[model samples]
Target: MMTDLVTSQPAMRRLRLSPTLSKYIARQYLSWFCSFFFAIVAIIYLATIVDLLDRLATKDVSLGITLNMAFLKLPYLSQEVMPFTILFAAMATFWRLTRSHELVVARAAGVSVWQFLLPVLASSVVLGALAVCALNPLSSVLLSRYERLEANYVRNQASMLAVSETGLWLRQADESGQSVIHAESIKPGSVALQQVMVFRYAEQDRFVDRIDAREAQLQSGRWLLFDAWLARPGVPSEFHEQLALPTDLTADNIQDSFAPPETISFWNLPGFISLMQAAGFSATPHRLQFHRLLALPMLFAAMVLLAATFSLRPQRRGRVGVVILAGMLTGFLLYFLSNFVFAIGLSGTIPVVLAAWAPAGVSLMLGVAMLLHLEDG
Candidate 1:
């Protein structure tokens, strides 16, 4: 009985992380993470700058503007690569610690794998929280600015569509001038507008005429208006059963004009989703993005678990190269799975909640199972 009590005391001590050990492990993990982050970000920035310069070679854009656009675009690309960064960082941290015999020392002291992993898991969760709360908003703002710059300097597209509590507004420009269109309601999946009004302006912003139409349909580079009444300056009003207005706009252009999900911040996503739904448009993409941000912390933790499975084995174990190759393959597979599921969500084939959460949830479970098999078996 006394021998058992003595053994249990040491085991209990091994189960808990001492303050010094926790800090040491956490610092090691964070150092690796920050190093990998900066390295990856630098690589992405350089590649993007090269691509942008190539694309803008024909345009009269200056180096300053190109650099500014690249800098603004960095945060969004960073967010996209963050998951892989975490995976690589955690793997490198564990592998280095094991190689240096630090984790071996802890194991020799009877510390379990889970006990030593606690610090890394906790740190990943904190990083994920910071990413979602602070980094995401900054990324969204910078990405939006980059898009605006690209539109103006690269694509030469004006802001074409906007939705509000009042209704939808559209503007199109041509050699003649510009026309502003308003519609009280739009069909959910088509370019059909009801209760439409069109205001035409000639060069120098001179008002030319106004047209009120019961319905407007965009077809083949023209707006086909039904039951339309046109009023011209210094002329009598005219009524027409059907009228065709020439436009360079098409269904594809109008659809592409909507703001993409990545342009919205995490804090603003819920409100944006609400506004989009209220405007009678499907909010699936925004809702999916919101839920994805919410699930990022769990995903980070899952990455830690997966890294541990591949890297925690002793150096004496053979097949190190095979194990690393397998780990990388697993990460790639998970990434493809995530993108596929997100595509499914965007298509509205599955619930937004399920599609957003499934990849992370599946990764967490797979990691846990792998760790259990490795550590316990």
Candidate 2:
């Protein structure tokens, strides 16, 4: 009994130290991550604020409002740079530890590479999950508000499109008057609407007339209606087989008018997707965004693996710079590839799920393969 107790004491002490070590590593990683993240955000803000400042000079918006837009947009931009932050932070952490021979000491103490890396990977995954589940909703709401302010104050525009259970609604304004257009359904990729109603309002906001049509086709600078009914408050409605209404809107403008995927919170996306589909608009972008958010944590975890694969080993004096640069370039390539595939998916050349998951899947696999080659080969 005395011998058994003596042997187990070392193992028990090691077990207790393991959690302490994990916490320490996670704290270091998170600190470095926040440092890199804010650094990048600051750089982006400086780059963008110049143009915003110029635009604001020509508008009535105050400097405070412009700064608010910049701050409001920061969260959404943070989500984009998070994976890079993880990669850089992990690489820096492991490189520092390895350079200082801490990892060598740990290995001599029987701690394997896998054991230390486990905590870093877990931390990255947790960060990714928090970004998607918590940060995303907050960013979306603020981004939507920023866009509204930009439209109202900076660009002098109003709401362009809306979706409801009954149908799709659109609004347009010109020097003559404003028009509200409604359609029971819309045909994606084309500027055509079915079962259309148009309400015309004069310069003083007086109701001028209403037009109903079985179908309307948006063409260059005009809308062509088939079987139209024109009605005025004091006159009997007149029916026409064909009528053309002047418009400043084009097909591209109409298609670009929907609430962009970034503005809708993750919690609200599924309902928005259903509503958009029901209203006969392509909900592909929203679906793609939701799937991407679903896959984000795994993506960030994969970044940890890749970072470790590059920096976990001992750093050689002459080769260290090259290795870090190569790792950064690799991350850049992965980002570009993900974007290319996403664009393809948006164009309907591939499935949305494939586009959304491919970046993380490929990163995870590549990282695993490299780690295997280094550790086991």
Candidate 3:
């Protein structure tokens, strides 16, 4: 009994860390994280600028606008690669410390691996939280602007659709001019609308006519309005049992016109989901995004754990290259797994929660298992 108690005391001591030591270790990890993060983002920004310039080569867009587009897109791109940044940053931090024998000295002093890792893990959690809460909204806003710029300058088209609690708004434009359509409600899984209004405009933005309809259906290249009343300026209103309006919009176009889930801020997702569902549209993508944001901190912690397993070794081990390669491969594998699972979730083949959380949960468990094998076995 006495022997057991003595052994437990050492384990308890190993679990504790001094505030100063914790702060130092956390600072070191964050320093490396910021360095790698900015370096990677800079490279991505340059690449994006080049790509934009190429896309606008045939267009008359100014270089300033092209640069602006890239800048707006950079935050979203950073979000996409953040997990890898954390993983590589963690790996570099641990590898450097191990090579410097700082961790080695701590281990000799009876500071267990878990004790020193606490600070890094905590830092990662905080970083992940900040990314989700702060960076995500910023990224979403910038990405939305980037899309608008791309549509206006690169694609030479304006946004065609918007959905909200009030209803759905759609705009179609062609050589004939433009029409704006509004519907208070939409039929589930179809392009049929109820309580519709269409506003027509002629060339040079001249007001042409307005139509109010009880129902409207989008067919191949036109909208068929039933029981519609047409009113034109300086002319008598007319009632029609049926009317057809030419449109460049199709059902597929309407579906594609929705704001991509990535462009919606995390804070706005829940309300957006509610709006979509209330409007009889699928909210699966937004739901998935919300869950993914909720799981980000856990994912970051898992990354740190995985990085530790690969890098917390002595410099004399002589397997540094192999370890680094293996770590990178593992990171890539996890990324692929996440994408594949997200696809399945988006297709409704798996629950959103499972698809969003599984990769991080699995990676975390694997990291914990490996750490146990190395430290205790």
Worst 10 residues of 2 by lDDT: 11-20
lDDT of 2: 0.88
> Which residue pairs come into collision in candidate 2?
none
lDDT of 3: 0.90
Give the per-residue lDDT of model 3 (tens digit) for 74-97: 999999899999999999999999
Global lDDT of model 1? 0.90
Tell me the alpha-carbon RMSD of every candidate: 2.1, 2.9, 2.3
Alpha-carbon shift of residue 237 in model 1 (angstroms): 4.9
**Given candidate 2, what's the lDDT at residue 88?**
97
What tens digits encode model 1's per-residue C-alpha lDDT throughout 1-377?
99999989978887677889999999999999999999999999999999999989999999999999999999999988888888988898899999889999988888889989999999999999999999999999999999999999999886798877778899998889999999987778877888999999999999999999999988897999999999998899899999999999987777678777898899998887877776667788889999999999999999899988999886556777777777778888999999999999999899999999999999999999999998888
By TM-score, rank the candidates, best first: 3, 1, 2
Off by over 4 Å in 2: 1-17, 152-156
Candidate 2 RMSD to the real structure = 2.9
